[model samples]
Target: MNGRLIAIGDIHGCHQEFADLLQLIKLEPGDQLILLGDLVNRGPDSHRVVELARQHGAIALLGNHERRLLAARRNPDKVKVRDSEKATYSQLDDADWAYLNAMPLTHEVPELNMVFVHGGFLPDRSWREQGADIVTEVQVIDRDGRPCKRREAPEALPWADHWTGPPFVVYGHTPRDDVYKLKWSLCLDTACAMGGQLTAFILPERRLVQVKARRRYYP
Candidate 1:
């Protein structure tokens, strides 16, 4: 297979698994690796995951988990705290928070007509405006689940299927048993931290490559 645009799913701080997957993919310096975010939290070595991605110049988006981590680090009382054997609230440093906050929520590669986001895209809105407008309007649920209105389907979100722009949106918030391709979107998150496989989709060719975790890496 020729080298192409490779987008990985939600990492959730499984540094070992993430590193193993990188080795499995045989990543070259020329290959572009797009990470779909949730890089930290719920797993071990969240700091390492961020650093590795940074060192490799990987394209990473800011997922909800990262948002929560930033929020917690900024103001711990606002969000409910959880205990885990892996890295937790007390473990993150100032640089970690800076790195998380510096990440963009969405990244668009107009040349390839591909857009990368931590979650799905809003078809009705531009990616630039997504954070300021939509994210704040929606009420955030617990870290473990999707944010939704009371009694609404978890998959249901404002403009969940609205993208009609040039670049096809590729995201990773909702994990699936397999890669999910919609009319204008693709979901690559296979929940690697939950003992599931981490997936990557090659754009245009739409080929799928995945690395399954050997065990539950997250607490």
Candidate 2:
């Protein structure tokens, strides 16, 4: 029983929607599930979402939210955010934080000539080059209204149609009202946490499937 290859967008803690989307796709035990990243934060049940991914043997990538959680854990004084965002971080336990930190930033499947990244990849660079070492530099807006750069690839490598590295690059982070499918990349983040739907792509077939959340799962 050969299973299909399914890649999901950022879940953002929308557990119910994620579960429903899986059922809609009829994900079987043999199926391979890959998550593009942002599995936690901004939505309800971030912990549950991560656990679900683990239970199903899914390959979950790291996203910016996860990095934020790590930063908050490391330097609580450095953490400054809205009440909602702060609460989300406060909910994370040591074990949950470890899980998020342990996730890989990108995953490559040579057979499909596809790479899964959380945001997008930098233009004109291979995934290997972009994700060479574990530590990465990420750009973020700081409290001083200045652009602060942090270590950790916050999102997928920025990509465009000019890319020729691989046939397909699946990623999340920037959720579109509609899934954006370009010749070389696919943006599956539906912003489920923001009252959108949870989306998944069936590889090889390039079929898109989604399940709308019952409510806004995130702030």
Candidate 3:
């Protein structure tokens, strides 16, 4: 039998909550944990979060925030630092950086029948043909295969309703008040950075596990 695939939502550096969630899960050797990105910034202990993910051999994909970190570091001058990101930046060493760098932009797990990514996938394009921007930035999807930036858009439909394959396009990056679960896709980023709950989606079982943050780490 295959191990259960547990898709964890955006951690946002709340290592304590992350750890608590793991404990709640009582992870077995036959369980596979997949971190859906946004592991750093906006909370305390980004280092610990990343390290824990590494030690567990979890599949931690790259998130928009991680991309921002790289972009900010690339710039010689600091324009604007985001919330608690300063701690995340200052604490990471070269190995941690490499580990983050080594993580894939997306993970295609055939066993789980899900395409995991930081952001929504392009509805009209093949996975490989998807542009970098679309793979990492889209929030909502309309009927015509176009991205809807706002849910209030007149033409907006669920991002997954129109999509096909893998049965699930599991993604993060877009934080919401509730877990985004549509016919074909799901968004697990429940705003852990804003002191919301850190969520996890258990595959096959189709169960949701969440642990509330101790306090608001970022405003």
Q: Give per-residue lDDT, candidate 1, residue 56.
A: 83
Clashes of each: 2, 10, 0
How does candidate 2 fare on TM-score? 0.80
> Which candidate leads the pack in TM-score?
3
In angstroms, how far off is 141's CA in candidate 3? 4.5
- Which residues of candidate 1, in runs, are more than 4 Å off? 1-4, 76-81, 84-86, 132-165, 203-205
List candidate 2 stretches off by more than 4 Å.
80-82, 131-158
- Where model 3 places Cα greater than 4 Å from the true spot, the runs are 74-84, 141-158, 164-166
Q: Write the per-residue lDDT of candidate 1 for residues 170-193, one digit (tens) a residue.
A: 777776677777677777878788
Better of 2 and 3 by TM-score: 3
Per-residue lDDT of candidate 2, residues 156-213 (tens digit): 2334333555647777777767787778877787879889889999976879998987
- Residue pair clashes in candidate 1: 123-162, 123-163
Candidate 1 TM-score, true structure as reference: 0.79
Q: Put the candidates in TM-score order, highest first.
A: 3, 2, 1
